[model samples]
Target: MLVTALTKLLNIRIPIIQGGMQWVGLPQLAAAVSNSGGLGILTALTQPDPNALRLAIRETRKLTPKPFGVNITLLPTINPPDYEGYARAALEEGVMIFETAGNNPAHLVKSFKDHGCIVIHKCTNIRHAKSAARLGVDVLSIDGFECAGHGGEEDIGGLVLLAKAAQELDIPYIASGGIATGRGLAAALALGAAGANIGTRFLCTVESPIHQSIKDKIVASKEQDTVHIFRTLRNTARVYRNTVSEQVIALESLPGGARFDELRDLVSGQRGRRVFETGDPDYGIWSAGVALGLINDCPTCEELLRRMEREAEEAIKGMAELVQG
Candidate 1:
């Protein structure tokens, strides 16, 4: 039973958190993680609308009575889904935990805190973390350059970012990006994080909603198998090194950089969703972190969580013995 501020705050036995991945964070995976004593998150916008989100929340509740969160990512889409509607739906469904990412959550933070909800905002750098802290976000999930999806443009990895966060931040934060194993969990604690947020590793779990082939590819991939795309557009995203992602990189390398309109068809979220639905890896670009190299097998959520707990304890104990004092 590894206890920390995150565990106490979320009322979970373990400090690990399952990242709210789009097209992946569903009832099955979220409930699995929560049942394993870690915080699980359902992607709110993954549902078609607020009504659908309510149903998904209800479905997750049926799977596990344990606490779970809803992830509402705020991005600048041409025709965005109803963000407030999703939040309200989650609140109406009695979900008190939220994981917000992309854009400042100023518009919704007050309402969430006022309703006694704990908001965990994901940030790529210290500047964004501090800004979110000032906005009254309960906790921060600090992402590194090795993270999947949008990793921001700073390109700072978790090692230096987590250490810098420990020195400067006043609020409790969890380390995100490139963390898959128990040793990674222990390292996050050593760096002053309340816990760790895992995305890519969780995606490769037995219970993950993705296709088996996708999981297999992740298991076989190395740390360098991921490519950082959209850097020329300023909204950098780390994705699996697939044919489509490589094509996007090529287009971005064109003179004056590629515009969002040119890459829109290739990077469409629907296309990426198909990759998960089907077993075709080259169908579209999918988000994957450097932690893919650390994942060797697809175990059940329960098996993974228990193993991580044991390994983290062993790692901490072994490190204590190394001290000369």
Candidate 2:
């Protein structure tokens, strides 16, 4: 059994975390990951309201008795959802862990701690990781530029990013972006990460709510099959390379750069949801990480976790044999 600060703290059998993906972090997937001994996260904002989130949390509980988390992403939305209400609902429903992303979590970190919940804040760079650590967050999920969704504008990949975090941060961290296999888990531990946070790879799993065609596309994709959009607006997001994403890039490159309003209809969340629901790859833009290159099959969560455990052990043992002493 692979154990680390994350495993011990979260009380999970393995040091793997399923990323709280929007339109995808439903109870079925979350419970499956947790049942497989990794921490599964439900996206709080995916629910329509605080009450819906409460129901989702309860539903997840029905599926697995293991510990799971709620992801409350704080993005700059003109009409933001009731963030506080969502937090209260999760707390009321007995969620003991949280994965926060997209903005400074100074406002909620203290409250979560007060409720005896562990806060795992996601950051894109060492600077932000340090800032989150200063806020007394229990753990950091340091995301690299290769990550899906908003990877920050800094564009740092996991190799240098994880090493830099290890060198600078005193708090435990989980490596995010481009991680798919047991070798990746072993490498994260080698770089001083308490665990690894996987997104794209988990999306291709059998229990994932996304359509099979999308999962199949992920399995067939290469490392370069993703493109970065919204860079011109200073809010870059990594997503699967598709006709729609390409169109956004082309528009963003024009003259003074395209405004968000111009790309709104094309990148609408509803449209992205359709792609997942309808099994269409180019229906809309969908988040995908560079790890898509490494994923080869759609295995059940249990099957995937077991395989990862075997692979991680073999990789770790093989590395130990290289020691000169």
Candidate 3:
């Protein structure tokens, strides 16, 4: 199968781009996915400082010589005493691709562009995608409301959003949200997308940094299992309906403590860090997509990417044969 504009821009073989996840998109996970032919994104603020980010980048480089990038989410967060410091580290480390989420990345964009880097900004809605496109980002990762982490409160599905993007913007945009299989890939292409970006399905894989217990929960989940929380503040995020998430939702409704950090203690950095590092699920409540239902096994990244490509090719060929007949 041919690579999408993202893969071509990132110089990777697979069109799949590992969503930059905080607490999950570690250097190990980034290297695994990139070396497997997909673009792995290292969460910029994943570490405490640029030194740690640099260390993670170096460690990932030690593991694989493939292309990778750093994800800078311009949202409210603690770490990153100096965001530019992390960006500078990424640049100094020779990180060629940069993926950003939330707000205008103009300063970072100009800097990264000056350094010969291709930028991809994840957007939850068409307006954001358009803004990113205007910022001259190399790619637009259209994260519909179905994706994990912070998704827009917008009710538009990828089916509707992709077409809306195609109608408004002429830039290369990829479809995300509820994508798991080759069929989703094919559907994305048919909807005028160059490729598909998968998160929840990828999280269930062995190469992911999330705990196996969380993966099990995702495996057991269905398309309707996820719910949107924090919508009242426009900081809405799609979270797996866990006991903790339920509490978070309940509290948000009553206005006791609705900040993202309220559950921060329940799922503390120390606790979450250990869970992801040790594969202990009970220690934390991680993010997941509704597409979890489509994931079944924890295969290696190479195996998953290769199989997806092969299956996509076969499915398309089979459809071609039918049309020919």
Candidate 4:
């Protein structure tokens, strides 16, 4: 049993955390992962309203009694939903864990703590990790440049990023981005991370709500199949190299290309959500990390976690023997 601070604090058997992908993170997927002994996360913003989120939380409970978390991403939107309302709804549903991302939740940190909820903030750099640590968050999920969603402007990968986090932060952190296989999990632990936060890998799981065709596309893809966009707008994101993403990247390279309005239609979340429903990878920009290349099959969450645990033990043992020999 590979126990860590994250697994102990979250009361889960494994330290693997399912990344809260918008539109992809539903009750079914979250519950399956939780039932498999890993920490699952339901995306709060995916619900239409706070009441809907409350219902979703209840739905997840019906599926699995294991502990799970809810992600409250505070990204900039034209008219953002009531974040406090969603948080309250989660609290009402007896949720004790929160995975906050996109923007600093300095305002909501205390409220979460008052309710005895453990907040795990996601950051892309050591600086942000330090800031979140100061806010009294229970843990940090340090994302690297290879992460699907907002990877920040920095280009550091997990190898260096996790090492830097180990050197600087006082709090325990999970390594995210480009993480899929058991070898990656072992590497993260060796780098001082308490767990691994996986996003794209879960998208191809049997319990995932995304269409089968989308899962197939991910399995067929290589690491180079992903491309970065929105850099000029200062909100970088890594996504699959589909037609829409390619177009957006090409537009960004033009002389008059530094504005969001120019590519708003091509990269809207609504369009990406449609792709998930329709099984069309070319429909819009969907978030995907470089780990898509590492996935070759659509295993059930239970199967995937079990395989990962076995592989992790073998890899660690191999390293130990190497040193002893």
Best by lDDT: 2
lDDT at position 314, candidate 3: 73
Tell me the lDDT of candidate 1.
0.93
Off by over 4 Å in 2: none
Residue 204 in candidate 1, Cα distance off native in Å: 1.0
Estimate every model's Cα lDDT from 0 to 1. 0.93, 0.94, 0.79, 0.93
Stretches off by above 4 angstroms in model 1 are none
- List runs of model 4 lying over 4 Å from the truth: none
Cα lDDT for residue 96, candidate 2: 93
**Which is the winner by TM-score between candidate 1 and candidate 3?**
1
In order, what is each prediction's RMSD in angstroms? 0.8, 0.8, 2.4, 0.9
The digit string of per-residue lDDT tens for model 3 on 167-218 reads 9877888888888887777778767787777777777778777767777767
Backbone clashes counted, model 3: 0
Per-residue lDDT of 233-278 in model 4, one digit per residue for the tens?
8888898899999999999999967588889999998999999999
Q: Which stretches of candidate 3 lie over 4 Å from their true place?
A: 77-81, 255-283, 322-325
Q: What is the TM-score of each candidate against the true structure?
A: 0.98, 0.99, 0.91, 0.99
